[model samples]
Target: MTDVPAPPTPVTALLRAPRHRVSPRARLMWQVAALVEGAVAIGVLLLVDLAVDQVDLPWWGVVAAVAAVLAWVAVVPQWRYAVHRWEVTETAVHTQSGWWAQEQRIAPLSRIQTVDRAEGAVARVFGLATVTVTTASAAGALEIDGLDRARAQDLVAELTLKADAVEGDAT
Candidate 1:
């Protein structure tokens, strides 16, 4: 007697993690982004604390703010890089993203309405780009960020071709 394993059901397939990780440089990019954001937020707090004499913020408050921002800069980027991943197949594109809260999305080729690639000023400095896939679903678009500039462009073209070849507008 032989035992055969059951095939992967759609639900199970959706639960499975995607195969590819974002570019390793994404960690550096994320870290820089965190630092920039922390700087802006901390700068604002310093202004409020220093400029507004009417509101005397405790020294601990300022210390806590710095500690929080430093923690975010130290943790978020590495966590995000570890957690975020994406993949595209003949039938669908899958993605998982986030640091604190994770989100997973699957978009089929037949349902894809548009594919776009974006390069943020900061991301461009790192030679990275994001590819966005818009689908007919009401949930909204799926974004695969932290890809190499060339890779993102290639993904956009590949998705466009695959979506175009499919028959019927997946509504």
Candidate 2:
């Protein structure tokens, strides 16, 4: 009997965010930065291993490696942590992200000061873009990176139109 491959896992509604989000350029940039950082970390660990070997091999070194590995149990999974999760509710945009200290941000469309998108080399290759939304709040800016450029522009236009419409209704 021919074995059929399992169907791909279906994405449930709850697991999905809005259709629009930050640009792909931004996501690519962040991902590239992460890869570079990970490489550097491995290099540092190698250096540390060499240096530690030159010194007396403390029993703690073994314990330290074990401990460090254990500690990474927490840090590693966080790399995939949702850096940006957003949804356009009727009233506002809600975002949630946190590796250690969790944070959630909400920005009403009316308060959006600017909407912009960026593209980079990776974005060019992948046809991705990033969208950033600034608000009156000094500490908060909404960025949705790693999106299709056309999609990003469409989203920006939609948000701007919505903001304008809301303003018109308020008057």
Among all candidates shown, the one with the greatest lDDT: 1
User: What does candidate 1 score on TM?
Assistant: 0.90
lDDT per residue as tens, model 2, 125-152: 7777767878887776877656677887
State model 1's lDDT.
0.89
lDDT of each: 0.89, 0.63
Off by over 4 Å in 1: 1-10
> By TM-score, how accurate is candidate 2?
0.55
How many Å off is the CA of 48 in candidate 1? 1.2
Top TM-score prediction, candidate number: 1
Q: What's the lDDT of the predicted structure labeled candidate 2?
A: 0.63
Error of 1 at 17 (Å): 0.8
